[model samples]
Target: MSEIQNKSVALVTQIEGALADVSPSDRAQSFLERSLDLYFALGGPPEAAAKLVTQARSRAQLRVESAVANVVIELAAASHLSDIDMIQAAYNRLDVELKAERSKK
Candidate 1:
């Protein structure tokens, strides 16, 4: 694969691993944000944008069956309580962004 493709794949892997010890919802939201950023960063054909969002949502739903329950548990286990709020805020921001991006479709 090309370097950019490699980078994207690596980022996906890293996101997954980072959130593996986390809760399902958090993992989904985090991965989606990370993927969306990479998708935007590597802008190209419209096809890429379409595929990127689809893949991101796919990753999110895949976490529904996961062991971790919600974003809080994941955040608390992964970081300090102070940072937990930040993580939720971040996830909310990403959720808004993703919704906007999807609305354009």
Candidate 2:
């Protein structure tokens, strides 16, 4: 599996280990501490992983919104939208956007 997937599995294992403890608050605190330690190990700063996750989610949302806007504008320019014709145009625009993002990377 990938590095992130391996980290996720380790997180699950940590939570499972904590589940057998007697105190609920201790278990929760332990889980959070373990998770934060892993994030710090992987991302350096305490908040680095969280920032990366937030940025990734924002980027994904922007991509979806951009693709939808492109579809609507392109279809509107043609003055009519059928039930299925806009699918190809929208996907083509998303493909272009993906290429652009990849090039920047």
Candidate 3:
């Protein structure tokens, strides 16, 4: 990797480690913001920093979405409901969890 890419990866790893104890809902945005801040503070240029931030944000979002999807799948499976009911219950649970997470902010 190039210097900026290396730095960006390192910063993202550091941010993830620092936020490891944090709740999932708080992690995505915090990871992106911290990566950007730390990159800039490390004397990265504006253009490079913006690129890094975009990449970081994309990664964080993907992780969060993946986790949510996994939970929905697990919940649906564990409920032993019919196909349609499983989908509905999974979505309802997701909605409630999302609202609860939002309220925490």
**Candidate 3, residue 2: how far the Cα is off, in Å:** 33
Please tell me which model should have the higher TM-score, number 2 or number 3.
3
Clashing pairs in 2: none
User: What would the TM-scores of all predictions be?
Assistant: 0.25, 0.24, 0.28
Ranking by TM-score: 3, 1, 2
User: Could you tell me which 10 consecutive residues in candidate 3 have the lowest summed lDDT?
Assistant: 7-16
lDDT leaderboard ranking: 3, 2, 1
1 versus 3: better TM-score goes to: 3
Which has the higher TM-score value, candidate number 1 or candidate number 2?
A: 1
Worst 10 residues of 1 by lDDT: 10-19
- The TM-score leader among the candidates is 3
> How would you encode candidate 1's per-residue C-alpha lDDT over 7-100 as one tens digit per residue?
4444445444443465645555766676466445445465677776678568646355353346446545444634445445555655565566
How high is the CA lDDT of each candidate model?
0.53, 0.53, 0.56
Instruction: Tell me the deviation in Å of residue 46 in model 1.
Output: 7.3
